[model samples]
Target: MSVPVAMLMAWFCEMLLLNSRSNQSVFRYSASFR
Candidate 1:
């Protein structure tokens, strides 16, 4: 694969992981308030 393509894929994966992590944290925070 090309260098740029690999870099793009890596960035995309990182963003997805970060989003999921944030979502989990939000859910946990809300659960704690209940």
Candidate 2:
């Protein structure tokens, strides 16, 4: 609703998206290694 709140939410969502993407890549890499 407020500008700062919206910006914070957007940043948080981006962080979560990046973390999940990195985790997926790591899982795939480890699976291949096995």
Candidate 3:
């Protein structure tokens, strides 16, 4: 429950979300190009 731990968790969640979005975008782009 420390501030640093909370910040780290938040950053991790944000990175996961970003990765998911990029994967979705890559899949769509590849499908369209093919």
Candidate 1 regions with alpha-carbon error over 4 angstroms = 22-34
Local distance difference test values of all predictions, in order: 0.62, 0.62, 0.62
Q: Candidate 2 has what TM-score?
A: 0.59
Alpha-carbon RMSD to native, per candidate: 11.6, 11.6, 11.8
Model 2 lDDT per residue over 1-34, tens place: 6889877766765576577865665555434533
TM for every model, in the order presented, reads 0.59, 0.59, 0.59
What is candidate 1's lDDT per residue for 1-34, written digit by digit as tens?
6889877766765576577865665555434533
- The TM-score of predicted model 1 comes to 0.59
Q: Compared with the true structure, what per-residue lDDT tens digits does model 3 show for residues 1-34?
A: 6889877766765576577865665555434533
What stretches of model 3 exceed 4 Å from their correct place?
22-34
